[model samples]
Every structure is written in C-alpha cells, then in structure tokens.
Target: MEIHKKFAHSILLLFVVLATSQYSCQAQNSPQDYVDAHNAARAQVQVGPIAWDDNVAAFAQSYANQRIGDCNLVHSGNKQYGENIAWGTDLTGQAAVDMWVSEKPNYDYSSNSCVGGSQCLHYTQVVWRNSVRLGCASVQCSNGSWFVTCNYDPPGNYIDQRPY
Candidate 1:
C-alpha cells in the first residue's frame, strides 16, 4: 500500500507540471502586445529594434488623422458652408449638391496607387452609430506619406441623419 501511494503521488505531480508548462507556453504574447510593452519600457530607458506592427499602426493612425483634419477643416462648423452641412444642423438641397460635387473629385479613390506588398494603404470611412456611413473623405498611408481619394454615393449619406 505504501509503494502504491508513492507512485500515485509522483504521477499527480508530473501531470500538474506538464499542465502548467503547456498553459504558459500557449499564452504567448501577440505582436501588438509586444509593441506596447516595448514602448512602455522605452519611456524609462531607450529601447532598440521596434516591432514592425507598431510602426505600421502608427503610420496608419497618422495618415487617418491628417485626412480627418482636412475634412474637418471645411466641415467643422457652419453646416451650410462646406462639407459639414450634410451631417450638420442644416440640410438644404444646395448643401446636398455641394456635398456630391466635393465627393466627385480626388475625394474618392477609384485608382489607388498604394496597392503593394508591406507598404499598402488602408482606408477607414466614417460611420455613424454603427450604421449610416459618412463615406471616405481621404485616403491615408500605413507606412508612408502616400494617400488616395475616397467617398461614397450621394456624398454624405447618413442613415441616421444626425451629427454627433
């Protein structure tokens, strides 16, 4: 009986160790997680060799911000003037026309040049309340300062028809 108990105990210990090791190994850190950790550590001391994912995300965000800023410039305030009227406090027939005209030019990317390997362009259009799409007002780069045009039909077609 004593020998049997010892063998059982050893088997249990071995199982526990194996399970723990498997769990730890399966909980690998993602690329984004590594980037965040490295950036946080760099706040205290200089770190070398930044991850590629971090660079790509940063570049994408910067390009998006630039496009949004430009559109907001003409549509921030005074709805009846520029692109703001579509989703602003005013929605006149003339305002709708102006919106379409604004979207017809380079504001829509029909022929984008940023379609390559690691240096491709991605666009995120403005959507309202998880529904109505506000269309694309600009194209942004994920790794460089390259951009294209973007827009949708009927210009600023908002299903909710409200600007928040």
Candidate 2:
C-alpha cells in the first residue's frame, strides 16, 4: 500500500508539471512581443525593422476593444494605415504574428503575389520595407475568444509594389 501511494503521488506531480509547462509555453500579448516577432520575420526577408508607435497602438487598441463583443475579423476602414486582424481562442501577440509569417511560403517575391490565390497580405504587411511603424493590440472577447490587430504605417500590400 505504501509503494502504491508513492507511485500515485509521483504520477500526479508529473502531470502537474507537464500542465504548467504547456501553459507557460503560450506567448503573452505585449507590445514588445508583437514588435519582436515582426522584426524577426522581417529580418528573414532582409526588410528594415519597424518601431512601435503609440498613436498606432492606440488606434489598434480602440479597434480591438470594439470587437470584444463578437471578436470578428473586420477592418477598421482607416485608409491611412495598413492593418491586419486575427481572431482565435486565447491568441497571443507573438502567436498572431507567427500566423502571419507562416504565409511566407505562399508569397512569391518575383511575382509580388500570393501563390494560387492564397492569402499573403498579412505576411507582406509584416515585412514591408517602407512600413517603418507598427502598433498592435489584443483583447479577449465576451465569448472568450481573442481578437488581435496590428497596424503599419505606409502600408505594404500595394498593387504593383513588392513587400521587400
């Protein structure tokens, strides 16, 4: 009986450790988190890095806040800045940026287009060489999903211009 109890306690402790590790692996939604992820992705394509902008972030935050009720992936309709929006369960800033970067394989620099009608705007916007400012925000909605948005100054996805 004593050996059985010890084995059970060890198993429980192992499970707890594993659970905590998994939770901690999830990224947080911080401004720096967003910037770091974006910079890393941009570096891969030799594009210049972008700095955080308070005004841009404020705009992003306001837009993100507005979606707390529905967490919809709607644009703010502001033409002055380039934008990207994402919705998911417990989404983090870094995770959202990673999701955008994942589209890299679909983007063809020579053609300056996404392959086979696939979506690559988000990826292009991230590494847009001329987009020097970036602001982002993330909010957890009433329905428990997360909404994330990032805005870029001088937006990237132009009709005939390449992102890099």
> What is the Cα-based lDDT of residue 78 in candidate 1?
22
Supply the global lDDT for candidate 2.
0.89
Candidate 2 residue-wise lDDT at 61: 94
Model 2, 2-24: lDDT tens digits are 99999999999999998985465
- Output the lDDT of residue 89, model 1: 22
Best by TM-score: 2
Model 1 lDDT, full chain set: 0.32
Regions of model 1 farther than 4 Å from truth = 28-35, 42-164
Off by over 4 Å in 2: 1-27
Q: 1-164 in candidate 1: lDDT tens per residue?
A: 99999999999999999898644432322344333432343333232323323333344334335654232222322222112222222222233323433332222234332233322111111211121212222222333222222222223333334211
TM-score of each: 0.24, 0.84
**Top lDDT model:** 2
Q: After superposition, how far is residue 143 of candidate 1 from its true place, in Å?
A: 35
What TM-score does candidate 2 get on C-alpha atoms?
0.84
